[model samples]
Target: MPVKYNVTERKNLQDPQAAPKFYASAKADGEVNLKSLSKEIAGGSTTVSDTDVLAVLNDLIKVVSRHLADGKIVKLGDFGNFQVSISSDGAETAAKVTSSLIRNNKINFRPGADLRDMLSTLKYEKYSR
Candidate 1:
């Protein structure tokens, strides 16, 4: 199946006076939450129940969160890697920068081989709203 995309109008932020430009952005058909995702996983395994999958996924999230907070990168094999990213204020010198200079932290996910391959071969179709 082809991926769905919607046309979007964007501006050049630096040159606000420039004419608007149109681009194609991928649009999700729908989203699956933990419960729905777990059911799908269970469907692929005869021995695993949806409840079992959900429990394991919940624990995985907790463990991953703890590892990230401890400054560790969590790698889920071919699933991807997750790490904490920080945006900080600049300091005149390296010595002048401290934890106080840190602005905010965000989780960054770098997709693994499977997702990269999917992206490489994806076909797109313009979505009609």
Candidate 2:
């Protein structure tokens, strides 16, 4: 069986009649319901269950919270740093300075060399007239 994935497209907010834009604008400002958003993305009449989406988002939040509590920097592959810092007294001055205040019992994940190399190899395609 082939794997299926969801692809999203960006819509222009400047056009009010642009196939029901996802976000609200001054012309038609209203609350954005998840069901409507899901339906639009699903590209079908099938209704999306809220539980599934909520579960995935909750899991992600839990993972990030756990890592933060452990004083460990959660490094996403090819992404930036997610570490906690604090203010500390500087040696040169008597005033406190903001710096990386890594606490005890922390785990930090430095991106692997392969990940860095892959990120650095990104190239954009040129548009032809």
The list of candidate 1 runs beyond 4 A from truth reads none
The parts of candidate 2 lying over 4 Å away from their true place are 1-50, 78-80, 90-129
lDDT winner among the candidates? 1
| Tens-place lDDT digits, model 2, residues 21-104 | 343222222466665555454564356455555555568669988888777778766654567654444465534433443233
lDDT of each: 0.96, 0.54
Task: Tell me how many residue pairs clash in candidate 1.
Answer: 0
The worst-scoring run of ten residues by lDDT in candidate 1 lies at 23-32
Candidate 2 residue 80 Cα shift, in angstroms, is 4.1
Residue-level lDDT of model 1, residues 1-129, one tens digit each, is: 898999999999999999999999999988789999999999999999999999999999999999999999999999999999999999999999999999998999999999989999999999997
